[model samples]
Each structure stands twice: as structure tokens, then as C-alpha cells.
Target: MEENTFKKGLIDGLPIGIGYFSVAFAFGIFALRCGLKGWQAVAISATNLTSAGQIAAVPIIAVQGSLVELASTQLVINMRYFLMSVVLSQKLKPETTVLDKLIIAWCNTDEIFAVCTGKDYRLDKRYCFGILIPPYLGWTLGTLAGVLAGDVLPAIITDSLSIAIYGMLIAVFVPAGENDRNMLMCIAISVALSLCFFYLPYLRELPGGFTIIICAVAASVFMAVKAPVGGDG
Candidate 1:
């Protein structure tokens, strides 16, 4: 039964694996361009399956941002993972051990969370491992390929490929926004705020990391206050 569940998870995670490959490939190239070695790029993807956060981190690293800047940037950008993990904990099998939770937490990407939590039944450890492993492999392999190819590829091609990351972000948010007015509003507000920070002289002078934190926290607060979901205070 556990074997069958593991197989089912692999089959369900196929598309996510494919998507991860392309995104991680871009990350590989980007990381190299940002001055990381090929091995470092691969190591990053293997350890941290976060596409957006990793991409955002590259510039900070290139600028030699302080530890506080790095930590705060990651915290604000990846804060959603905290909520995702909490939701996933509820869907885990009651018998899941601390070790299992730790492993699952380490490998919990957004795609993994989506696949694991979308199931109606409590997730078994084997099933979670099956879903987690393939994408993890894909991401690492893709990053390796990208880092190797980054130097050989023409500047034009490598530069153009950078846009793929933004495309991935749009792919995630656009469909959900179409269905949820509140989410749509939140996205719009966030984008507007981000643009303001970019264009306004004073705000533009603020550290990029802090700007992101302010924009994200402000948008979340505005949404919570203006469009609180069914729950009470």
C-alpha cells in the first residue's frame, strides 16, 4: 500500500518536476552570472528549493549585503512557507514522527506543499518522499546544466532567459487572482507599492530588502483589514 501511494505521488508530481527543471535551469544561469560557481549553484538548489527567494538573493549576495539584510530579505520573501508548513502539518499522518516532519519540512517547496496538501487523505511519509525526491533531483540537475551552460551560452540568450523567472511568478499568481477578487486586489496593491518604491526618489533610496519587507507587510495588512476572510479577530 505504501509502495502504491509512493508511485501515485511520483505520477502526480511529474508536471511539477518539469516546471522545476526549467525554473532551476534559469536560476543556475542567473546564479553563475551573479558570481557563484557551478557547484555552488547546484548546492543551493539542492538545499533550498525556493526559486524566487534564491533569485532575489543573488543580487543581495553580489552586493555583499549584510547578514541582517540577507536574513530579513529571506524572511519577508519566504514567509508564506511558514503558513504552508503549518497547513501541511495538519494533513500529515498522525503517526508521523519528528524525523519525518523534519525531512518533510526541509524538502517542502511550494509545489511539494500543493501536491501533498491537495490530497484528501493524510499524507504518508513514503508518499511525501516520492513527491519530494523527483523534483529535488530535477532542480539540482537543471541548475548544474544551467551553471555549465551559462558561460558557453551567448550573452543575448542568457540575458533573455532571465525573464523566465518573472513568467513563472505570473503563472503562479494570475490564475489564482482570476478566481479570487481579494487576492487580485492584494496583488495589484503590492505591485503598485513596489513600483512606487522603484520610481519615487526617496523610497527608491531605501534598501531593496527593506522595501520588499515594507511592501509585503503593508499589502498583507491592508488585505487583512479590508478583506478579512470569514474568520474573526
Candidate 2:
């Protein structure tokens, strides 16, 4: 039964796996450029499952950044996952064990979360595992290819390929945009916060993780207060 469930999850995740490959490939190339060993790229891809965190960490890795810096940076960037996990946890069945929760938490990338929880399917450990493993493998394999290939590919080709991951992000965000007014407002707030962070020297120096928390929490709270129960406006 678990095997069949895994097969179903694999079939569902096939398109997502293809998209993750391109994104993970870009990360591998960036990791290589940052002077990481090919295996290191694979390791990070396996563990991190986050593009922004990996990208942010590259500079830290290059500069031999302090542990504090690395921890703080990742904390700032990945703070959104806290909210995402909260949302996902609510959708899960009550019988989900602590071990299963551990796996789900580890595997809840932007893509995986969408695939697992966006549908009405009640998720269990087997279902989560089936959904988690393939994309993780695709990401790991893509990074491996990038590191091994080095800079052999033409700049134009690589640049074009890099956009595939961003395209996936848009696909994730766009659906939420159509159905969720709060999401649109959150996006607007994010953009505004980004602009402020870029131009304001004081804001620029603020920790990235805390900045995200502040912006997300403040915006969410404000919107929750302002918006009606039905989410009008």
C-alpha cells in the first residue's frame, strides 16, 4: 500500500521534479563558482532545499563568515517557513506522528508544500515521503550535473536556463494571487519592504531574518485586522 502511494506521489511530482532540476542546477553552478566542491553543492542542495538561503550562504562561504553570521542569515531568510509550516500543519491529519512531522518539516520546500497540501488529499507519512524523495533527488542530481559541467556551457544558454526556477516560483505565487487577497497584499508589502531595505541605510543593516519576520507579521496582522471575515479587500 505504501509502495502504491509512493508511486502515485511520484507520478504527481514528475513535472515538479523536472522544474526543480533546472533550479537546483543553477544552485550547483553558483556553488561551483563560489569554490565549493561538487559534493558540497550536492550536500547543501540535499539539506537546504532553499534557493535564497543557498545564495545568501554562498557569500558567507566565500568570506569564511562566522557561524553567527551564517546562522543569523539563514534564520532571516527562512523565517517564512515558520508561517508556511503553520499553514501546512493545520491541513494535516491529526494522526500524523512526530517522526512523520519531522520528515514533513524537513521536506517542505515551496514546491513540495504546494503539491502536498494544495489538494484536498489527507496526507500521511507514506504520502509525504513519496512526495518528498523524488524532487530532492532531482535537485541533488541537477546540482551534481552543474558542478561537473563547470562553465562549459555558453553564458546565454545558462542564463536562459536559470530562469526556469524563477518561473516555478511565479507559478507557485500566481495561483495564490488569484484566490487570496491577503497574498496579493502580502506581496505588495514585501515589495515595499524590499524597497525600504534597499534604500534606507538603517534598514539595510537590519538582520535579514528579523526584517522578514517584522514585515510579514506586521503586514499579516494589519491585514487581518483591516480585512473582513470573508477576506473582502
Candidate 3:
């Protein structure tokens, strides 16, 4: 039974692994362009498992932002993971130990969270590890390739590949936005707020990380007030 669960996790994670490779490839190229070493790029992917946050950090790092700036940026950009982790904890099997949960939490990316939570039963450590391994490898390998080839790759190709991450984000959100009104509304709100922040002179000065945090919080609050779930008042 454990073997079956592990195999099932690997099977379900295959698509996520493919997606990670494509997205992380772009990230690797971007990181190299931002002056990170090949090994550093690979380390980032291996340790962080986040595209948007890492990409955001590159420019900040290039600018030699202070530790506080880096910490705040990461906090705002990756705050969703904290919420996801809390939700995921509920989906873990009762027998899953604290250490297992800690390790699983460290490995939890958005895709991994989705797969683990989508399961009909609570997830075990083995199944969670099985699901995490392929994508982790794919992301790390892709980053390594990008870093190594960054100088060798044509400018046009690298530029084009950089757009892949945005495409992936759209792919993740669009389907749910199509099926759910609240999701669509929340997306619209976030986009509108982001644009406002971008164009408005005063708000435009805000850092990208803070902009994302404000937009996310405002949109979520609006959505909750306007369309509370579970028929709650």
C-alpha cells in the first residue's frame, strides 16, 4: 500500500515536474543575467522552489538591498506559502510526525500543495516526499542548465523564454477564474490595484514586494467582505 501511494504521488507529480522545469529554466536565465553564478542559481532553485519571489529578489540583490529590505520583500511575496502551509498541515495524516511535517512544509511549493491537498485522504511523509522529489530535481536541473547556458544562449531566445513564467502564472489562474466568479473578481481587483500602483506617481515609488502585498491583502479583504463563503454573514 505504501508503495502504491508513493507511485501514485510520482505519477501525479509528473506534470508539475515538467512545468517546473520550463519555468525554472527561464528563472535560471534571468538569475544569470542578474549576475548570479551558475552554482548560485542552482542553489536558489534547490533551496527556494519559488519563481516569482526569487526573480523579484534578483533585482533587489543587484541593487544591494539591505537585509531588512530582502526580508520584507520575501515576506510579502511569499506570504501565501504560509497560509498554504497551514492548510496543508490539516491534510497531513495524524501519524505524520512533527519532523515529517517540517520537512514537508519546507518542500511545499504551490504545485505540491495543490496536489497534496487535492488528494482524497491525508498525505503521508513518503507520499509527500515522492511528490516533491521529481519537481525539485527538475527545477534544480533546469536552473543549472540556464546558468550554464546563459552566456551561450542567444539574447532573443533568452528574452522569449523569460515570458514563460508569466504564461505559467496565467495558466494556473485563468482556469479557476473562468469557473469561479469570486476568483475572477479577486483577480480583476488585484490587477486593477497593481496597475494603479504602477501608474500613480506616489504609489509607483513603492517597492514591487510591497505593491504585491498591498494588492493581495486589499483584494482578499474585498472579496471576503463582498462574497463570504459557506453562506456566512
Ranking by lDDT: 3, 1, 2
Candidate-wise lDDT, in order: 0.79, 0.78, 0.80
Q: List the residue pairs that clash in candidate 1.
A: none
Tens-digit lDDT track of model 2 for 96-180: 8888898879878878877666666566667677887778888888888888877887768878888887687788777876887
- Candidate 1 per-residue lDDT over residues 1-233, each given as its tens digit: 23328787788667677777767888898888788778988987888888877888888887888978778878866777887888899988899999988888987887778666556578888788778878888888989888877767777765675566456557667876897899899888988999999999899987665676678678979999998988322
**All candidates: TM-score:** 0.71, 0.84, 0.80
lDDT string for model 3 (1-233, tens) is 23327777788777777778777887888887787777888887888988778888888877788989878888877887887888798888889988887778777888788667656566777888889878888888988887777768777776676666566567677886897899899999999999999999999998776787789779989998998877312
Off by over 4 Å in 1: 1-4, 33-35, 52-80, 90-95, 111-127, 205-213, 231-233
**Which pairs of residues clash in candidate 2, taking residues 3 or more apart in a chain or in different chains?**
76-209
Error of 1 at 27 (Å): 3.2
lDDT of 2 at 39: 90
Report how far residue 115 has shifted in candidate 2, in Å. Answer: 3.2
